[model samples]
Target chain A: MEQILANGLYLGAQYALIALGLTLIFSLMNVLNFAHGQMYVFGGFVTYTVVAQWGLPFVLGLIASAIILAVMGALIEVFLFRPVIRKSKRDESTMLLAAGIAFFLDAVILLLFGEKQRGVPKIVNGVFNWDMRIIMPYDRILILALAIAMIAGFIALMQYTKAGRAMRALAQDRVAAQLMGVDVDRYSMIGFALGAMLAGLVGGLLVTITGINLGMGGPTSIKAFMMIMIGGAGVISGAIAGGFILGMMESVGLTLLAAYGDITYLVIFASLMVFLAFRPQGLMGKPWG
Target chain B: MTKTYAVLAAFLLTIFVLVPVTISATGRWDLYYTLTSVALLSIGAAGVWLTFYIGRINIGQGAYALMGGYVSAVLMTQAGFSFWATLPLAGIFCAAISVLIGLPILRLRGVYFAMITLVLTEVTRLTALALSITNGAKGITSIPLPGELSIFGLTLIPDFSTMDSPKPAFYLLAVTLMVLTYLVLWRIVNSRLGHLCRSLQQNEELSASIGVNTAYLRVLAYAISSFFGGLAGAVFVAISQSIYPSSFAVTDSVNFMLYCFVGGLGYVGGPILGTFLLYFGWDLLSAAKEYQLLIYSSAMIALMLVLPNGVLSLFDRKGRRK
Candidate 1:
């Protein structure tokens, strides 16, 4: 049980990183970006290139990847979301456009990375064991610490920053935000860029834990979407709650199903379906005003 | 869907009729399975279309069809039941599962719904992969077709099971199931229930205000869609003589949605037309094929940018005039 909880928390951290981006987009744009998984994968690939291929310093590689993805996120928003939001295309447009971007990204990754899975060497090596009693990797511990710090930083930024207030303004109403001199469009671009950076950081962390490839992007995106949905799309709190719940579920389920030699993605799917049915906005999503 | 259906119907008819005759005449034919594959896929896509028309994008439809295929095969191969009994059982099982799933999935909107159903689809596939009854990822293989059914010494089964070849099967598939689908959709579209779904789609609040149980209606649509999905799966199982998880994945569900969108959402012909163009391009752009997804993505982006209403609406000036 202790192992399960610990594993779940570790897994949950990964989900929180992924879901944060998804939740941010959902809250702001009312559009769920399907290409989110690709953004995360791109992060992993960037980290791999820097650390694995170019033999750059690990910290620089991670920071560089996040910054690069932030720019890419801005570009994606300009090319895709702007047109849909401007034209009042609403949710349908988002669905179609997001899927298109994901498809394009999936192909791009395939072209760039080939089909083989690639993994980056752990940023911090060795395990922290209490005299071989409670064994866990130093790398994973770093990830958990990083995840907690990131979430805390995010909460601080959201609550205290001027940029955060502007983001909230835009989230409530683009027209109202613009009228209030909030520069709604600019802030949204910032949010997209910021969200992408978050995804990249998560991606980099993920590659240290497991190999990533183009094929994993879509599935991972789905899981992230599920987390955001359960967490409540427009709420930061929801993202955190949903991510941890999903992480715990996944870890526990995977471990239990090991006796059967495989965990049924269908069961997880079934659980997600039940979750959707009961709470359309998700578990932590703020009710409609 | 109309355009997709028309194009698919024409293309399959051509391939079905021409490919075999051409092969017999010239004798260098290699792609014997083209028509069979196209027809089978179209059938599956048509089932996909049914869900989209109801204003819900069901990515899990492929899973339901896969379920139908597996259940049908399992019953016939393992349980020693006839195809007729297993076929109905497949449809029922699919409907039951969809209803069970619909109870929850219909609650979600936009990406959540799409993602959840997609996960369900992968789950269904994984369940099949994990189940001993499904042969545990090795897949249910070598399913036997009914040889003949004679009541008063009359043969009902095709002499050699017409599904074996791409041509006769295409005609049989296109004319029979396609026509049935067309009629069913036409009837539904012209009915009051169809109008309600469209109304709900246009404005959920207004539809709810008018006292329509929008939730119930959505579930109904989902169940109906699942029925066809199972039916298509049964036929596919018959044609392929095997069932595997690869045939139905989360990707198929997403592809199904794209096909419906391209065909034109909420229209009788959208899925048919969408499936047609998708398969046509899928056939035409077989080079390296990995780039096919990119090509598909580019096309979708172009379409969304150019015409959000879909290509079908382009030629439907008459419908617009109405």
Candidate 2:
């Protein structure tokens, strides 16, 4: 039971990390970046290259991946998303554009790295013990800690930072924010960069836990989407709560329903259907205006 | 207008009749299968176009297709029902299932709905992998070719297995189905229900306020969409003679949406043209070997950017200018 709780918490933290970026982008741009998971996979690959190939410290590799992906994310927004947004009158094409970018990213990664799965070595090779029965690994604990720290730091930045204020303003009222001298494009870029950085950070952390592969992007993106829906679309706090709810559900569901094997997806989708039927706005999401 | 449609129908009939005869005469079996697959895909894409007409981006149309395939496959293999008998049954079954699933999902707006639908194929695929009836990933194989049609022991068409080359037969069946599917779609587009659906696309809330019964209309369109998807799927299984979960994966669902987008969502005929071009276009790029996906996806992005309304829009502009 303790093990399940710890594992669930660990899973929740990772999910929250991924969900943070997704909700940020959704709130700011009114678009979901389908390529977000591809960026996450790219982060893991970057960490693998930096730590495993270049013999860099794991911490430096994580930081490096975050910075690299943040820049890439900004560039993607400007080049791929911006042009399409400008051309189309409606936001419908954004999904296709993101899918296009995702396809391109997948193709590029497949070409560059082949299909082999790669893993980052654990930063600190040791185990943590609480008494005799309850055991936790140093890496898992570090993941949980770093996830909390990063999430808290992001919350602080969003609440206190000037750029973050501008983002909030833009999200609330685009035209009014523009009238107030906030550059919509710049904030959109920042939103993408920040969101990408979080995804990269989670990816780097996840590599040590689950390893990295090209195919991880599609499933991870779906999981993030599920989390956002459960938490409340475009609500940051809701995303965090939804992540934890989903993680616990998976861990508990797996423990009880072990014989089912991969029924978690079915359960998640079923619950999502039920949840949407009753409350489409989600638990924490503001109703669409 | 009637004269123009008559000429168009005659032209289509001539092409469909002549092309297969020419291909078979030349003994081009590969071209036969390719054309057959394209026709089958266009039928499925037409279903997707209906939901698009109702302002819903249905990324899960492939799920209905998969369901349709399995329904036909299961009924044929297990119950010994003839394939011809199962086609409409499969479509009806899928339509019923879509109505059940679409009720709750259609409430969410925009990306939230799209995102939910995104995982649908995955869920269905997983279910197929888990369920015993679906054979759990091994999938139901050795599915017999469609049985013959007869009236009181008088054979109308021979069984597919008896044919020396089933490709030509399958091609003709597929083309006939495609023609029928598009005709239905064309009729729908011109009907009163189609106009109500179009109103939802422009301003759903306003339409609802004006007593459009928007929910019922959305559900109706979705049911018809899934019905067509199922029809296409059943036809697909008839051609392939087997049904596998991966045969209609999430990528196929995405491709279905892309077909409508690339064809021009503005018109009913868009998916027919879009599926053919994208289908042949992908095959033409097979020579690029490992770079095919890279080049293909790049082209997809470049096309969306260059032709936002789709390839049909170019003709649309020309028609307007003239």
Candidate 3:
């Protein structure tokens, strides 16, 4: 039970980071950014190239990933999503553009990073064994700490910063925010960049533990979607809650259903569908928000 | 109406007669496979288009397609049913499944609906992998070719195995199914049901207040849409004589929606044209080799950016006006 709780907490931290970025984008632009996972993978690749290939410090690699992804997210928002959203009458038009960007990023990653799984050297060595009950690697403990710190830092930024307040207002009501002197386009771009940066940070953090690969992008996006759905779409607190709940479900499901092979995910996804059917607003979100 | 008939005749002649003859004369037998795939994919895209018609972003058509393929495959290989008999059964099964799935999820907002449907494909794929009847990861293979079809002692279609090459037969089957799917789609779009669906699309709350059975229309449209996906999948399995859990995946689901978007959601024939162009355009970009996907995706983004209404909008002088 202790082992399961530890595992779930670790998984929940990383999963919440991924969900936060996606929900951020969704709330700000009302564009369900399909390319968010690709951005995450790109971040992992960036970190891999920096720390693994270039022999740079892991901290430097993490910073590089954040900066690069933030820039890419900003560019994508300004060039691709903004114009498409402006011209198209229907809001869903951005989905096609987002999916296209996903394909584009996937192709770019394939060409640049290749198809092999990539990992950075562990920052810390040895295992953290506690009474033979809670066994986790030192690297995993460090990653969990970093992930929590990042999440806290993100929360602080959103709660206190002027840019964060502007973004929150934009997310709450775009037209109202615009009327109140919020530069809608600039804040939207910033929100997207911040969201993408969170995905990058999580990617970089998790690379040491799970490794990264080209194929992980789509599944990551789907998993993130599940998290956001569970938490209530576009709600920060809900995203975190959804993340922990999913993490717990996965950890418990995998441990208990070991004899049943790989049916844990199947069950989780099935139950998620059923759950969403009953509570479309999720546990914390407003209806149709 | 006469002009419309004439145009339809010319279009049919081009696809059914001229294209085949040209391919044969040019000795481009490989083109048959490509064209058949386009037809099959467009059939799925038509279903996506239908969901779009009712103001929903359906990213789960791939689930129904995979289900349809498995249904046909299981029945034909395990139950000793002919492929012809399994085709409609697959479609009906998919429709029934969609009704169950659509009832709850269809009520969500558009983005939520899209996200849920996106996960549905992966769920279906995982289910296929876990289920014993789907043959797990190895998938069902070496299924027999479609057998002969007859009605009242008259043979309508011969067994595929008896032919020198089943390519033409498969192509014809796929194209015929594509045409029939579109005709049904066209008919639905023009009917009173279609108008009610449109009202649901425009404003669900308003439509419900104005006496539209909004829930029923949404579920019905979704079912019909999934039925098209199933038919496409069944035909595809027939062509390949195999079924796999990953046969119709998330990418295919996204592409179905992309077809509707790229073709023009406002027009009935949009997905067909979009599939043809995008499929062929990707094939044409194969010359780029390693950069094919990069170029194709870039072009896709640029297309969406510049032609947000889709390629069909290029021919429309006044743009899409409801």
Candidate 4:
């Protein structure tokens, strides 16, 4: 039980960070950016290339991932999403645009990073075993701590900053924010950049533990979607809650259903469908919000 | 009306007669496979297009396709049912299953609906993997070719296994199904039900307030869409004579939607044109080898950016006027 709890908590922290970026982008643009996972994988590769291949410091690699992803996010927002959203009559046009970008990024990641799984040298070594009841690597513990710190820092940034206030306003109502001098386009770009940066940060942080690969992007995106849906789409607290819940489910399910062999995800996904049917608004979100 | 019928006849003649003759004359039997694939894929895309018409981005059509393939495969192999008998049964099974799934999720808003449907394909794949009945990972293979079809004392279609080459027969089957699917789609779009669906797309709340049975219409459209997807999948299985859990995957689902987008969401024929162009375009880009995806995706992005309304919009003078 303690082992499952520890595992869930560690998984929850990282999962919450992934969900945070996706929810942020969704709330801001209503775009449901499919490329978000590709962006996350790109971040992992960036960190891998910097720290593992270039022999740079891990901290520097993390920063570089954040910076690079932020810029890419901003450019995509300004050039692809913004213009398409402006010109297209239907809202779902952006969905196509987003899926296209996802394909584009997947291809780019394959060409640049190759298909092999990659990992960096562990930042810390040593297994923390408590009475043989719970065992976890020191690296996982550090990653959990950093992930929590990043989440806390993000909450602080959103709650206390001026840019954050403007973004919140834009998310709440684009027309109202524009009327109130929010500079909608600029804030939208900033929000996208910030959202993408969070994905990158999580990717870079987790690279030491789970490693990264080209094929992880689609599954990551689907997992992030499940998280957001469980919490309530576009709700920060809900995303975090959903993340933890899913993490707990995964940890417990994997352990308990070990005898069944690979039916855990099938059960989880089926239950999620049933859950959504009953509560479309999710646990914390307003209807259609 | 006469001119329209004439033009339609001409188009049918071109596809049914001229194309095959040209292929035969050129000794390019390989084109049959590509064209057959396009025809089958477009049937699935047509289903996706139907959901889009009712204001849903259906990323789950592949689930129904996979289900349809499995259904046909199982019926043919285990039950000893003829392939002709299993085809419509597969589609009906998928439609019924979709009704069960769509009742709840169809009520959600657009993005939520899309997201849920996106996971559904993966769920179906996982289910296929976990189920003992689907033959686990090995999948059902080496299925017999479609047998003969007869009504009363007359043989309507000969057995595929006895043919000199089954390519033409398979191509004709796929194209005939494709035409039937689109004709049904076109008829629906022009019918009162289609108009009601369009109203649902425009404003579900307003439509509900004005006495439209929004729930029924949504479910009906979804069932029909899945029916098409199932039919396509059944045809695809017959062509390949095999079924796999990964046969119709998430990428295929996404591609179905992409076909609708690339062809033109507003038109009935959009998916048909879109599948033809995109499939052949990918084949053409095979020369690029490793860069094929990169180039294909870049082209997709560029196309979306440049022609947001899709390629069909280029010929839509009325759309331009608006």
Q: Can you write out model 2's per-residue Cα lDDT over A25-130, one digit (the tens) per residue?
A: 8888887888888889989988998999999998988999899999988998888788877876457777777787888888888987778999977787789887
iRMS of candidate 3, Å: 1.0
Q: lDDT for each of the candidates?
A: 0.76, 0.87, 0.92, 0.92
- Stretches of candidate 2 above 4 Å error? B2-7, B152-154
Over the stretch B104-125, how does candidate 1's per-residue lDDT look in tens digits? 7776765566666777777777
Q: Write the per-residue lDDT of candidate 1 for residues A75-172, one digit (tens) a residue.
A: 98888778766653335656777888888888888887777889987778898876654567999989899888898898788879999888887877
Q: What DockQ does predicted model 3 obtain?
A: 0.80
| lDDT (Cα, 0-100) at A226 in candidate 2 | 86
**Model 3 chain A: lowest-lDDT 10 consecutive positions:** A269-278
> Can you give the lDDT of residue A284 in candidate 4?
86
lDDT of 1: 0.76
Give the alpha carbon lDDT tens digit for every residue of B1-322 in model 3: 9987998999999989998999999999999999999999999999999999899999999999999999999999999999889999999999999999998899887788898999999989999999999999999999899999999979999999999999999999999999999999999999999899889889999999989988999999999999999989988898898989999899999999999999999899999999999999999999999999999999999999899988888878454553
Q: After the best TM-score superposition of candidate 2, give how far the Cα of residue A111 lies from its true spot, in angstroms.
A: 1.2
Per-prediction TM-score to the true structure, in the order listed: 0.90, 0.96, 0.98, 0.98
Best by DockQ: 3
